[model samples]
Target chain A: MAKNEIKYLTAIKADKRVKKFCRFKKYKIRYIDYKDVEFLKKFLNEQGKLLPRRLSGNSLKFQRKVSDAVKKARQMSLLPYVTDLLK
Target chain B: MQLLQDLKLLIIILLKMELSAITGFLLAITNNQKSFKNDPLSLGLNSYLCRPKSVFADSFRTMRNVHWDKPPSQMLWRINRILNLPAIAFAKAGLKQKGKMNNYELMVIFTPVLSDDEFKAEQKKYAKLITDAGGSIVAENPWGLKSLAYPIQKKTTGLYWVLQYTAASDFNEKLKIQLLRDEAALRHLCTKLDKYAVEYNARKKSGAKTGTEKLAEV
Candidate 1:
């Protein structure tokens, strides 16, 4: 019974997906500036909320920077705070 | 006879000294208390001399009852003046160095209801403002009638005009105030560009021009 369980656990481990690479690091982006709206849009959802680091595959530091940049952009009306479905 | 003459001179000197001493005493009595207050040393002595014995005891009681948490107004003013030195120096430096132009990017959104001629005229008016302030326009891009993500003043569309210019740092404040006062402008943002951003913008504009030329050829 223990051998069967071990075989099942190993199969689950093998089936797990590979970790994704950070896009900013891959592109060698030194700074995540607020003015780069096109580049920043990749990290935002349809509702204008920032995607989690886990889902976006961004490094923890870069994710923080991106969130800060997004806030600044929103303050200047460069990006929307929230998207309305009816609009 | 010479002894008699010496006695006479001594009497004259004594009379002169007595007369001077009486005049000095009269002058001291007539002097205003305000004159003593102007001199720090005299003011300290005057406070001690002028106050009655009971007042001195009352002052000691007041000193014991003083709230140490809130300092005297004079001390607070002194500290505030010291803290403001850096800001004062910055203002002085800004005044001394005039006409040192810096690169700036201004993005203005006009209300979408204007005709083409009016829009062109409004653009010329802003360009004139820049020139009047000793600034030169580098590039102007009119991104006509774009839809806003959120409605501004109940308007869904706005006419966007982006301007790149070089002007003195001080001119930005004046330009911003003018934009705010203008009824035609829906919204405006002016950003000071560092050397890196300025160079990047120049390169990007050149690349865009060449790309357009190539497209036209094709």
Candidate 2:
């Protein structure tokens, strides 16, 4: 606990930007469709893995739907189960 | 006394808004509503709500190898039997959803070598196959020559046709067999649509655009 370190901590600032919200809830979407490939892709990373709820800005309820849709899309070949980084 | 209290809590939840729909679905199936019985859950929940004790006893009888030497373990086993009622019903329902028409959607990729007339005829033939088998086609969308996300059968592009239909649970097997026999089909997938999916597809066809669909236009 140095006095000089306390002075340096004053540079920290609170973020004022708007927080992320669940897109499905904002739009009142009751269903997540696997056939809607482009929409499902938004919830996947470059490696084609499902993005976590924290990263995707989705709530727990909507996150479940998203994961279910992603898996179904993979099964139907609407989306890749995995992708190469180069691709 | 604890069991009664738990049932009371369950009843209160059933009466509330959160589970009313689920309770209503259960009640409808219990009443033997034909249309509602299409969902596999309806059967399980039906038996569960109407005669849980009978199912519990039957299922427990099948699992009867548990040693009855200890009284405390026997008491715990009784509790476990009560907890397994819904699970047993669901297991049985999952296996036998026959003679019930439920929502289904089929997607097929036809080889790109087909002529325009051939494509039309092929789509019509499949549609007829569904109707002739006592099922109804809700919508038939021909996406027409879309590039595959990955190479399928060494082809980079395919004719994508999607069909939404309601049929008995076993009917998809017959459709899959037919698709396999048809040399023109490159790939095929048939999926069972839950209630939400049925509503979503209906809404999509009714000109209510989903978010991605609107973005696709731009």
Candidate 3:
């Protein structure tokens, strides 16, 4: 892929809603672009299907909301819900 | 009669200038001259005593008529337990309280991958860990899957578990150590419950038990 061609998955993660919530919550987005989705997905697989609060740096209330959103995106083929792709 | 005199003397010394009203109220309630239990007037005063600025609010609110000629330790524990209820109530009502405290409430969240069996097993392990460390298990509720503020371990939705327990000070550190080591634990929080809150709970349970008994009789 050309450098100028942005990764679609990365763009979704950096979407305004995602960034705004993450920024407000002081969480660092690890995926730079769609190119890194596979890497991030692998890391998540390692943590099991659910993520820990410290790594995500989200309050309990917001953490639940974000987890649901991730699952929804996975079901819609927006994101990979399982670990097979990363492996 | 002599015991009452000794109690009066003790209250006079312990309470100083407030002895008169305290003594009068005790006599009124204990003699059944007036039923302080569920008395609206006393309830109003009790509420007033709950305010932050009342100088002796805690003492005034918690003081009970004891046979003072008896050991102080017995009276102290009884009153302390009585006082614990309102303290918890105050905290639940969002009032900050002062004292050296012991906290026992805990919340634990887990990832979604674990099956019901796995979750129950972990819950049992954690409960045992808590009680072994001198905590009491209050309740454990499964909150089902919920969304996160951000993705974790790559996925978003995760299984949720809430556990309420009463434990000692060191229990927090012990639990955290095990949680960090376990891959299943996503998040956990522990908050201290005031002793007064515990007392309030006991009184509530007693009231509920009586109400149930009354219903059964009818």
- Point to the candidate with the largest DockQ: 2
User: Per-prediction DockQ, in order?
Assistant: 0.14, 0.25, 0.01
Model 2: docking quality category = acceptable
Global lDDT for candidate 1? Answer: 0.62
B97-152 per-residue lDDT for model 3 (tens digits): 33333645555667888888998898899989977866678766676677654576
lDDT of 2 by residue, A4-80 (tens): 65455467666786788877777677788888887777778889898898787888998998898888777656777
Estimate the TM-score for candidate 2: 0.58
**Candidate 2 ranges beyond 4 A from true positions:** A1-6, A16-21, A84-87, B1-99, B211-218
lDDT (Cα, 0-100) at A9 in candidate 2:
42
Candidate 2 lDDT over B1-218, as tens digits, reads 33443354355445553433356333542433344324445433434433323323332222222222334234333333545443344344332222458899888999888989999999999999999988999999999998776777788788989999998777888898999999999888888888878878888899786554542332
Deviation in Å, model 2, residue B65 alpha carbon: 50
How does candidate 3 score on lDDT? 0.52
Relative to the real complex, the DockQ score for model 2 comes to 0.25
In angstroms, the error of model 3 at A5 is: 66
Q: Which has the higher TM-score value, candidate number 2 or candidate number 3?
A: 2
Better model by lDDT: candidate 1 vs candidate 2: 2
Residue-level lDDT of model 1, residues B64-89, one tens digit each, is 12422233333223333444323333
